[model samples]
Every structure is written in C-alpha cells, then in structure tokens.
Target: MVASSSPANIDKSIPSNEYLLEMNIKKVKNILIANRDDRFESLKMIDDIQGLGIDLHFQHEIDQTLDMIYKECSQFYRYYGRDPHEAALCFRLLRQEGHSVQESFFGNILDKEGKFEDNLQNDVKGLVELYEASELGVEGEETLDSVRKFTFNRLIELCSGRESHQEREIMTSLMQPRHKTSRRLTSKRFITMIKIAGQEDEWLQSLLRVAEIDSIMLKSLIQEEMTRTFKWWTELGLEKELLKARNQPLKWYTWSMEILQDPTLSEQRLDLTKTISLIYVIDDIFDVYGELEELAIFTQVIERWDLERLEKLPRYMKVCFEALKMITTEISMKVCKSHGWDPTDSLRKSWASLFKAFLVEAKWFTSGYLPDTEEYMKNGVVSSGVHLVMLHVYFLLGKELTRDKVKLIESNPMLVYY
Candidate 1:
C-alpha cells in the first residue's frame, strides 16, 4: 500500500464526498506505512479523514475502519507477535473516532493474547504519553496510571513466561491506596447521579460496566494471589495468618464494617458489594453449595494436611481457607433464610454441588497434582464461589439473567484459575 500524500497535498475545494473517498484510501495506506514507526502521523491522517464529513455510514465505517486497522495491526502481531502499545493506540483511535466496534475488537485481542513484551515497555510508555496529551476527559489520572501499571506488569508476565509473580503484583496494585480510592470516588459519583435522576443514564451505565469489568479482573488477580500465597505457606512449612482478619469474629466483623464505612469504600459501594459478594459466593461453593463427595474430599484435604507442609498444591487447590469458610456460611445462610427455606434440607442442598466441587479441588491441591486443563476448567465452574455470588446478587438486584448469561460467565477462561 502506498503511503498517503503529506498534509500539504490535499485539494481543499473538492466536494465533500469525493474528498472523503480519496482521503479514506490515503489514510489507510498512510496508517499501514506508519505502522512500523511514527504513530502520530497515522493518527493525524485519520483525524483529517474524520474531519471530512465522510459518513462511511456509521456501522459500515466502524467495521471497515477496524478491518483495515487490524489488517495493518496484524502485520505487527505477525512480526513482533504482541505489541501492546500499537494495539492500545489502535483501540484509542477507534474510540476517539466514536467507533465502539474497534474498541471491543482490540479488547478481545488483548484479552486473548495477554500482554506485550517487557523490552517494548517504551512503546507502552509512549502510548500513555499520547493518551495523556489527548485529554479525553476520562476521570481519575491515578486510575489510568493503575491501569498502565497493570498493563506493564502483565507485559512482564508475558516476557518471563511464569505468571505467578506478576499476578501477585497485580493483586497488590489493585488493593493499592490510590486505585481503591479512585474506584470508590467514581462509584459514589455514579450512584448519586442515578439516584437523583431516578434512572440509569448512559454514562453512568457505562461507568458501572467498566467498574464491573475491573472488579472481575481484580477478583481474578486476588484468586491467583491466594493460590501463590498458599503455595508459599506449604513450601516453607509456615502457618501464617492468611486472611486479613484472623482470630476475633467480632473484630473481623468490625473491621469489615470499618472498611465499608470508609468514605472511599462507601463511594465504591457497588463494586465493594460485588467483591464481597463474590468472596462469599466462592466460600459457599466450597463449604455448602457443592455435592457430598466433593465436600468430603475438601474436608479430608484441609483436615488431614497442615497447609504449611505441602510442597505444591495443584493450581485449583489454592483458595484462601478462611475466606472460603467465612463467605460461604454468611451468604448461604442469608440466601436460604431470605428465600424462606427451612435452612436444614433446602438450604443445605442449595450449596451441595458447590461444596463437592471445592472438596475435589482441595484434594487436588493437597495431593500436589495438576489436572488436565479441561478438567480444571470443568471443576472451576462448580467451584467458583464468586460466580454463585454474582448470580445471587443478580437475583436480589432484580437484574435479568438468562441461560445465556450463565453460559457466558461459565465460559470465562479465568474460571479455570479456581
């Protein structure tokens, strides 16, 4: 593809349609050439085309533009195989031009491939600089910075090829003071806006969606950290206090209350609720939601072995024990009583399947045996306390959920992470 003529070569007086057609072709070509080096020039070309009043027809334009961009993007992936900077830029431009398709497209691409290499950190840094310069009016520079830090950390994971350490860093970062504060602020603003309007506004809905996605991601990271931490405990033969609140039940409850009462946490009530709900859901699955055989195995594992003595548990076996117990007992009791169940038979069976799955997972962990990926994934579906928690929340919140929704949640690959 031939690069477009420089900005100096455009004929200013042509009819808008013809000008747009010519500009489109030139822009595509220019972007392709500049794909290797010089992203700014390509962005400029796109901006010019956008200014031309070309209605490539909104949906058609979005589709064609993404196709062309990805075609060029594919070259970078084909050669270097994973340049997140280029990918991030590509998506940012698509969003700037009001093309949601490209944004979704790039998210899928990044989600599937993980992150770019560490040597290309400069590429990511440059992209951040460009994004800051653009001033898109997104809230919270610190939140964006957290995202950038996360992206870089993921890149490091990709480079090292062992994700445990990088995953730990991601968990720590998510719980960082600045990130949590920003999340709380954004959540409060959103809820307040909705309350005053008495309806869900588009912007608020979008913010909630973003928050949900972020929360889900953080939970996944936390799960990973739990696994790694468990491994460390087992390897070192150290009985460390794993849960944030350990001994005093009243103290734990008080601490939880304090966390909730904090202005930052209050602001992010929705997200915090979801996260806590997820923890409880996971706990219920392991303790009460699963089947008899599964529960038996889980009990056997936890009771038989000193967690600190095992060398390496299978990946699925690494859940936080206290978290599992606390969340399960709390949420299941609430859900059962609320639903008017007798709490013995009805409530007990409600969590039977989940418990069984957790037990199986614990057995695998204590045995230090890794199952096949497919088995791991299957077990994950049954074991995910968080998934059940979300389901309960959806039901309680009066949100619509179909079989399709359940499938989508089940299909998430991270479910395999236990």
Candidate 2:
C-alpha cells in the first residue's frame, strides 16, 4: 500500500477550496442516501438541492430517485391525497422531471364547480406551492391557469397584510415563480428561508454548507470567466474599430451566465455571449449606422458569406463582417470536433437570414413604411436574432443531432416566439 513514490501513485495536492467543495458534495450525497426512502422528504431535499444551485453535483441521484418514486407510486395523485401542499409539491417535482403529470392531479383541491376550493384561499403554504406548480402549465391548461390566478391573488392578499420574512418570500414567489427565477438568485433567498426558519436538521445544515461553498466557488469562476471574456473583447477591438456598434460585453455575459447557470457550461456561456455581442453589434450597424444601400450590400455579403466581396463593403461593414466570420468559424470548429459535423454553412445561413430580416426593417424605416401588426411580427421573428442565437446554442450544446431536430431548429419553431 505504501506505493506513494510510484508513477501512478504520485502525491498530488488538491487546492484547499476544491477539497472543501468535494467534501461538501460528499456530505450532500450522503444526506440524499440516508433519506432515500422518505418520499416527501426526499422530494423536498431534491427541490432544495436544485434551488441551492448544487443539483449539477447530484443529477444522476436525483434522476434515479425521481424515476423510482414515479414507479413506486401507482396512483400518484391519490398517494398525496387531501394534502394540498403535498399534492402540489409532488405535481411540480414530477412535472419538472419531465413526467407527463395531468392537471387533474389537483382534482381533490377543486370544488364541484370545477374551480379551486374556497378553503385553499386561506391556506398560505398550500396556495404558494400551487402557484409554483402552476408555472409548468403549457398551452390550454385551463385548470392550471385558474390555479395560478387563485393562488396568485390569495398570496398577494396575504402578503399585503404583513412585512415578515415569510411575506417577503411569498411576494418574491408571486413576482416570479420558483421555476422561472434564476437559480443563483433564488439560492440566496432559499438560504435566507432556511436560516429564518431555524431548521436544525443535519441534512439541512449540510445542504446549507454546500450551498454556501458553491456560491463562493461559482462567484470565483464567474469572475474568471468575466475576466477572460473581457480580455477577448478588448483584443477583438470591436469597440474601438466599430464606433457606432454597442459595446456591452458585460451585459451580454450576464445573459449567457443567467441562461446557462451550470458551472460546467463556462465555455458554452462564453461562446453564447460572444455570439450575442456580435448580434447586438451587427444589429446596431443595421439600425443606427448603416445607410440603406450599405445595409443592402452588407446583407448580400453575409448571404454570400464570401470575404472576396469585402472590397465592395464599406469600412465599418468590413470590420463587422470579418469579426462575425471569425467568431462563426471558431464556433464551427469546436462544434465539428465534438459533434462530428461541420455547422459552418448552417451558421452562415442563420446570420444571413438575420441580416436579411434586418435589411427589411432598415428599408421600412428608411421609407417611413410601417407594416401592419401581422406583417411586422412575421418579419420581427426573423429579425429578432433569437433563431440565430438559438442556432448557435444548439450546435454548441446539442448532445444528439438528427435530421428532424436540425430541421426543427432551422425552421425557427414557435419556441423562439416565446
């Protein structure tokens, strides 16, 4: 056993913070292991893990637990029958885990009139849970829509009468449901809730410790990412070169970070932020700087994706075009290596489509022609740059790529509208 000098048994040192992080993760996993049999408690712990932004560390365990829970409980809704909080919590968690839970799961909470029972109006905890669960509703779920309104209005009324921590928490949830809020932002609130409630359980304490450590580590990593991104931006010199273009790399980085909060997505976040920044820069060129003729030429250049046409472009257009080409190529190279397919042409076409849409808007603006709402929205969807951004995101993080999935993404599906 004393083979410390062996090549394979070299004594390597983990940084103290990293060591601490590993220990905390181990503690949290142990807590999950110990409480694996308690359905309600296990679900609550998973929710806490997610809310605390440490679910990335236990994704497999969380998935296994959810799958097991789904299997063990045949009559899922009836299992948590008569307890609104339990029922709503179960519904929300299962739905979040990609289970096709029915809206009628809350049937016990509904009155004969097919509306939520009046008694639930006064049950603050139940109402709050129901409000959060209702957020997972998709198109045409009348029951969830009604539940949201009922819970929202009751929670609003309840919070209006008090200035307590619980009231603040309720107001925060009412403002943005738990599912919609940023994990990092909500984790702070979750930590505050735990401390205020004086939860003295060992698992809660471990969860809290892990959350605190994670927050610190995440902050450091984000700072590093910001520094690196800023360095790249400065070296790109777009701000100095393209004076009229927006230079909001920090804001762009915020979008990337918030949208992709998992620490493991650092590279993807940077690529996304870079793509977004270019979108803004190119958008500004079209809307603010470029003459209609210049924008038209720029659109054609992008459509062709030929740098040989660079001689015909104006100085500013050339700068923007080169930067766009470079970024697109860099992303394509990375994606091709990982996904085993070149996305270069697809990426170019996406940008070309965006520019064409922008040119349409530019022409309309120049001629003082305001299209009808339908016409404007139809064009606006393309000009929105959502498809462009999402295209890049798909290629960057897409695990599996089928012809159908590629077609769906390229079609600019209804997902981008929302």
Candidate 3:
C-alpha cells in the first residue's frame, strides 16, 4: 500500500560523498613528523591519532617517529617515567607501536612494598592510563594481573567524584581498551571526548581536524568497498546456487571489517569479505543441507584442490568449489605480484584443514555420536574455523613465517582456549 507523500516525507537525496572539505593527508603526516622530537608532545599526539581511529593511515610515520624516540631516550625509564600518567602512556604506546617494552617500567610509580602508590589515586589521568595499560597483559603476568584488579576498582570509585560524569571516556577504556574495541566506535567516541575536553596545542588541534576529516573519508571508502563487493557477489551468484543458505554479503563484509579494519586494506578487505561470503554458503551446506556422502566428497575435493575434482562435487557444491578456487587464485596472484610470495599452497592447506574439521562435525552430527567432554572440546576448537581464518589472512598479508612459527600457529594451545 502506497501512502500519500507528505511534507515530512519529502525527498532527501544522499550525496555520493559526505566530505565537503579538502582532505590533505600529506599535511597531517608532515605535522606529526615535525614534532617527533618532543617526547610528551609526540606521545600525546600518537594517543590522539590512535584514539581518533586514524592510526592506520599514519602507521609508518608513527612507527618511524617512535623508533627515533625509543632509541634516543629510552625515556620510558626516567623522570617522565616517574609520573604514572606519563609512564603508563609511554608503556602503552610503546608496546602498541611494536617496540619491546617491559612491564617493569611501572616500578617507578610503585612503592617499596611493590604496590601502586596510594597518592596515585588522586591523578585521574594516571589511574585511567594504568587501567588501560593493564588490560593488555598476557597470561601469567603477575604485576599486570594485580594492576588490572587494583585500577578497575579504583577507577570505578572515581565515577562518584565531582566532574567525573564527564569521564565517560575513562569508563569506556576501563571496560575495553582502545586496542581491543572496534575502530569505528572508538573513533567517534574519542573524537567526541577530545572535542568536549578541548586541546590547547595548535599542532594537536590541526591533527585532530585531520583525524576527523580522514575518518569521514575512510568511512566513505569502506562504503564504496562494500558496494564493489556486492557487485562481485552478484557476478558470483551464490544466491541462485545455494537456495537454502542465507545470502548475506553485507554481514560477511561487516565481520571482515571487525577482523581487519585498516582503510588501506580496502581491496584486500573486499577479497576477504567475498571469501567469507562463500565460506558462509559452504558452511551452511555442511551444517544443514549436505548429506554425509556429499559432505565426504566435498571435503575430499577440497583436499584434492584441483580443477578436475569439480566433477566429484554435487551440483550446488560445484559453484562453491569453483568460486573458492577462483578467489584463491585471484588472491594468490595479487599477493605474488605485490609481495613476491605464492599463497596458493598455504591457502589450499588451510581450506583442506577447514574442510576436515567441518567433516568431523558432519560425521558426528550424522552418526548421532555424543562424544565425551574432552573429545568434544578438542574437535570443537578446530571446527570453529578460527584457525583456518587466521592462517589464511596471515598468509595473505605476506608476512614471513618460519617453520617453527608455522607449527606454533597451526596448533597453538592458546587459540584453542582463546
């Protein structure tokens, strides 16, 4: 039923691009580079750059700048180190920049008894930084475990203090540190926080403007990438082939964004999203549609990993296999050209491993086998498709993988539980 158009329902056209201002990326890079010498200033700039969610664009610049600062001062261990706010900030940023940092730096703020000093509670910024820094701790790190527990309770108490209502940013950080949160949400949240609090430095103000403008453009770029992938999806025609499976290109793209959000990875993101979309169809077949015999053939086809094996797969699965093979080749060719490595072998291995895991579940489900807790848990981890996804992306990125590291990645104990 069509309703009569009213004034309130009047047409509003969406612009092709949201940005009206000139986006000078070079200018932002130059500004950050110009101040690489000032430790406090540079660290603050890095934090804002990250908080604003525009870090990916300036990563190389940030890395070089931090490298200079890291070697020049080891300032992570001195007078600035004595201040909890500065020390925590340095430690967090240093570790984030991929520089090796020791948690021992926190000793500067601790007392002879090895506790975060009582006086440190008065410093809101210090407590917030400590809380955030502590969140990055790995297992078995006693100091970080202790600090996380202490700062969490301490920061919760600060919410009652005057002007504390404005500390929503601190509250959010306590819940999930910047590194772990979605870039899209954190970018907007941090921009709001900084806008309200206001920075006094001219350079910071300029950089902040750049971050805002850049983030807007990046959003538009992602939108375009989504559109392009949708077009690719149409060409692939998964909806026609897999009538029972959910035809969800958009959702797959969103999931990929959560996995790898860098704007520069736009093309890579599209490829990955497309791969996941196909994975969704294939996964649904294994889960619900495919019979045991068909599932076995499909798993074997993946293991064989050849064009000739297409004849062995069932009708709908031929589409899935061909699509997977085509996409893998496309990704492989690009990676080879751009980074000089052949990802085909590794990708095939990952796909074969994933199919084996899927077949295990299919076998279990069909046989009505109720495995014991230990057996179920062991199979369930690999069956989760996480290892397959991680290994595929790792190979796609063209990072060097030593034999030992590859072994570690393939059967990492942490990933099973993680």
Candidate 4:
C-alpha cells in the first residue's frame, strides 16, 4: 500500500525518474525537431510516438509536422503516393489530425481488378500498417473494405507460419488495431515488444524510455486520483447504507479514467467517477433493492426532482436521491461558474429520462412483459447510462454551451446511440 511518487511533486525537487523523464522528453523533442523536414521520417516518428503512448507530450510537434506534411503532399500523395506503409501511415496520421485526406490514395495499391494487389501479401509491414489504417474508413468506402478483408485474411494466414515478434504484433493488431484501441493499452505492449526485439536505434530507445517513464508517472497520477475519489466515496457512507448497491468506487474511477485519459482532466475524471458511482447505486436500487411500488415512486420522485416527496420513499432510496441531487448541484454550480451557463435543467432532464428508462425495465420485470427488440433497444440505449455520462462530460469539458447544442444533446443525438 506504499504510495507512488506523483508527477505533481516534480517542482524544484524532482525524483531521479522524474528528472530522467524530463531529459528524455527533451531528447524526443530534439528528434522531432531534427526530423521536421523529412516528411516520411516525420510521419513514421509521429506514428511511433503515438504508438508508444507519448503523443500527449509532443502533440504540438506532431500537429505541426502533420500540417506541413498535409500541405506539401496532399495533392501529390493523392496521385503518386509513397509505398503502402508510407501511404497508409500518412493517411491514418493526417486524418487523425483532422485533415481531409482521401482513401482513394490507397487505390494505388490496387490491381487491374480494382482489388488490393496479391503481391501485398509478401509486404508484411505494409499489410500490417495498411490493416491498422483501414479501420479509419467510414461507411461505403469499398477500397478500404477490400483492404481490410485482404489484409485480415493474409495476416491470419501469415500468423500460423511464424512465431516471430513481428507475427505476434500482427496478431495483436488483428485483435485491436491502432485506430480502435486506446494508446494507453497498446503503448505498453509496443514498448515491451521493442525491448524484447532489442531495438538499438537512439530515437526508438529514447521514445521507449519516454513511454516507460510517462506510463509510471501517469499511473501515479491515476492512483492519486483514485485515492482522492475513493475518500469522497467512503465519506458519503453510501456503501454501508445501501448494502445491496455495488460498492465499487475504484471500478468507477477506472472507468472514468479510461474515458478521459488526459492528465490535465483530473477534475473531470473525479467528477465523472462520482456520477458513474451514483448511477450504479441508482441502478441497483431499481434492479435489486427496491420493490416495484417503491421503484415506481422513486422514478416519479426523480422525475419531479422533488425533495418533498422524499418522505414517502425508503431510507436507502432517499440516500441515493439526495446524493444524486448533491452531485448534480455541485456539477451545475461549477459549470455555471466556469461557462456562464446553468446546466441544471439539462442535467435534471437527462437524469429524469434515465430514471424513466430504468422504471420501464423495472415494470417490465415486475409484469413479466417482454418488449419487442426495437422497443427494448430504444429504451435500453437510455438505460445504458451512456447518454447521462456524456451529458455530464459535455458540461465538465466546458464545451461551448449553445442553446441549440443543449437542445440537441437533450434530445439524445445519434452520436449517443452508437
């Protein structure tokens, strides 16, 4: 249970590891600065930096490099793009940086049949990079679709032939491509793979060191956040009061951290963890603890946002309702102070909708009614608590609060559906 050293403690007196972390960050910056004009090398470096999960430290550099690359090569790349690895890497990296790059660039690798050329199978690195990049395609991009299928089949076939580090990487990518997986999870594996392979390039070695140090420091920060959040959870005494509720403060904290992994988002992560914890408690109330009649009343009281109706509920339900109100109020006040807009109405309506959705399921369970697939999915989406979480996220991030945007979010836009 010994505490890890947090990055916050790295002021004038820094730990040796923290000092090393700083020096290596500078080393990375030097490498990035040196390679600024080399478009292909710059793209690969950015890809490596991101793959190593150290991109946050070099975001500005990465952005500048990508901007330069896109400006210089956008049109040329469309016609005479580099090899598959370079073309695919550039396309993925540029699109990720919000550049309007096209997938047609990949068509260069296609043969006369308008399919990925069979010769790409021999280019394992190209196919791997292309496989990872193909995930960025939107709906109806037939070229990307073909690339995905082609690379997947070839990668799978290639996996059974060799057990090398490269093959392992292919298998890993097949399971979770760069575009689909979180950098935090994938970066550690990449670092370990490079170490296992004994890569000796100064840039690669320095990048790995940065990733290691950053991972340790990031873990420390998250540990501290979790400790602070857990203290808040324990102080509420909800665990003892609502015995049947899932007492999982750490779980909630981890979930929030995963969603908002930026180091600067500590406050947002903590707030989100609290909201998610309360959601679990409320869910347990509706699902496991409360009787049908009590759940009905509870849903009604939540929808009404009525403190007066608390007397009619069980003590556990009251505890949950009060906790919900307190957190909602805290969030609303903070948001109002920061953004000059009170989100109380929007927040309440979201919670009310959630509770109503939960109540629908509670009634269904009580009456043994099986809803049709469409009806069930529609309600299930709301009860999934994703919209509620995203609503809080919108306010917590201090996004521009337009009246129309508020209305759009409250209506549960299509983004929340997916």
Per-residue lDDT of candidate 1, residues 1-418 (tens digit): 8878997768766545434434444444444344435444454334333322221212344445555655665444343224544544555555454543222232322343555334545443444432332233244444344445555454345445446754453343334422123333344333443446435544323323333444454455444544543453344221232232222223222223334433223222322243343344345444434444544654454444345532243333345444434444555455345553222222223245455567777678667889998898777775765444444444333234455654555345354343
lDDT of 2 at 317: 81
lDDT of each: 0.42, 0.85, 0.76, 0.85
Superposed by TM-score, candidate 3 places the C-alpha of residue 205 at a distance from the truth, in angstroms, of 2.6
Which is the leading candidate under lDDT?
A: 4
Ranking by lDDT: 4, 2, 3, 1
How many pairs collide in each candidate, listed in order? Answer: 21, 0, 0, 0
List candidate 1 stretches off by more than 4 Å: 1-100, 103-126, 129-182, 185-350, 365-369, 401-418
Answer with 2 or 3, whichever has the higher lDDT.
2
Least accurate 10 contiguous residues by lDDT in model 3: 14-23
Best-fitting candidate, scored by TM-score: 2
Q: With candidate 1 superimposed using the best TM-score fit, by how many Å does residue 244's alpha carbon deviate from the native?
A: 12
Task: State the lDDT at 293 in candidate 2.
Answer: 81
Order of candidates by TM-score, top first?
2, 4, 3, 1
Q: lDDT (0-100) at residue 272 of candidate 4?
A: 94
Instruction: Write the residue-wise lDDT of candidate 3 on 200-317 in tens digits.
Output: 8565566667777676787778889889988998898878877889888889899888788776677778777877776678779899788899888888888887666668667888
